[model samples]
Target: MSSETDSSLPTVAVFGLGIIGSRCADQLLNQGYHVKTWNRTPKERADSESDPISAAEGADYLAFYLKDGIALREVFSSIQNQLKPSQTVLNHSTVDLETTKWLAEQCEEIGCSFLDAPFTGSKVAAGQGALVYYVGGDSEVLESARQVLEITSKEIKPLGPVGSATVVKIATNLISASTVQALAEALAITNAYGIQPEVLTESVASNASGSVLASMKLPTMAIGDYDTHFSLENMLKDSRFALQLAGDAGLETPGIQATSAAMEAQCKKGHAHLDFSALFKAYDTA
Candidate 1:
């Protein structure tokens, strides 16, 4: 039915209107794709549907950008029997590996193709349509979804079948959490020694250890500006998923383990909803 609007573009139904989903939905609409959107709490948007089933009806691509595996599963179950074999489902949330595989299996049971397509990039990237997707699915399924995917991504890196992207995403988040924790410790040490926070930030930027993440996060952390590009709680959830993967392989990841502990402390102190760089707040009292 959506093809009636534009024969070339498939109708896309986007679930979740959190930071990334909301922006991506806007991008799809702006690009002339017929988009149906739904958020659990309901948002005042013209494209928003009253229920998940309504949003998904007759959709060619059903994209989920939910908070966690729990939310994803709940919504998918509500619409599972209604799904047609012609539809392709994309999971863009970074959730546990078990959940990722579960989603794939469920889709297969209904004869619908599924893609484990969690992504990287935060609120700003979503707004700019520059998110990078780490996709895991059959190449043909990917090609079928490419045009809609490209509406919100700068690049699509296809890794392999069904669950690879989720693994890569969790591993990458472990590094990010550890890196921010290290940056927080370094900033606290330098500031205690009569060194300016900005100086340390500049030094890191010029050092071999510098990164795009540091450049963007360091200055903000220095001033206690944790403005939620990605929430501390979301990063904490991903870190735990990483630990689970490592533990299953009989490996110890002390760095992310310690960082997860720090994030938990910050979350207890009521900073969970802030940007993940709020890890620095753990040292604000020290």
Candidate 2:
């Protein structure tokens, strides 16, 4: 098992080196922390091994940006027995509230502090060390980790106790999906009339219906190609996550339900791995 080699600098063990996880590991390294990186597929990056338990064995903080609840659960279950009281865990995955709260309870039993710290901004923001974190945990834990997390974030907001950050992440993604889909519908209607998208972009920019989501997606929609910042698959999961949360609260969210359906339809059409902004192409009447 790997352990902190240097006592002066903090040691961070990172698992699941996908886009967000990889960038966060780099940011921690840049901040002068001893970074131990691991991934299921060891060949994806140099110096990263496949043994997650060993990577986290003696780390001060263990961070993860895992794929989903099942994957995150498996990793945690594997290491839960080995976790030391001195370690803290920061989960950056976008999972449901029940699972996150369950993790909080489980980790607490093993004497490891846990934080649900899902985030916003894209791979672009990650590359630039400017992602925004939505955190949920004990207040003192959030305060202690704020500076370390800031190594990859422009903002770190504590929403409430465990599971709150996961809810906020789902809510924000639902809004974002609706915003992008609304812009797609508007552009498709304009295209039906032979109106240029440049004209539509200008109109939205000047109108009360304007939004950052629409503005950011305009250029991608105009070019008929997406850059894959956030995958349609991930966004679709967020849409479903919103519906599940609403159901748990006994609320009927018709708009979000419809939005989730649209997202599934787009994903079913093989756009699953593209930038979710490509949902605009679902409305390309031309």
Best by TM-score: 1
User: Which 10-residue window in model 1 sums to the lowest lDDT?
Assistant: 1-10
Please give the CA lDDT of all the candidate structures. 0.92, 0.84
* Per-residue lDDT over 1-286 for candidate 1, one digit per residue giving the tens place of the 0 to 100 score: 1223455678999999999999999888888788899999999999899999999999999999999999999999999989999999999999899999999999989999999999999999999899999999999999988988998999999999888999999999998999998898998899889899889889998999899999888899888888899999999999999999999999998988999999998999999999999999977763
**What lDDT, from 0 to 1, does candidate 2 have?**
0.84
What TM-score would each prediction reach against the true structure?
Answer: 0.97, 0.93
Superposed Cα deviation of residue 200, candidate 1 (Å): 1.1
Off by over 4 Å in 2: 1-7
lDDT of 2 by residue, 127-157 (tens): 8889999999999988878777888899999
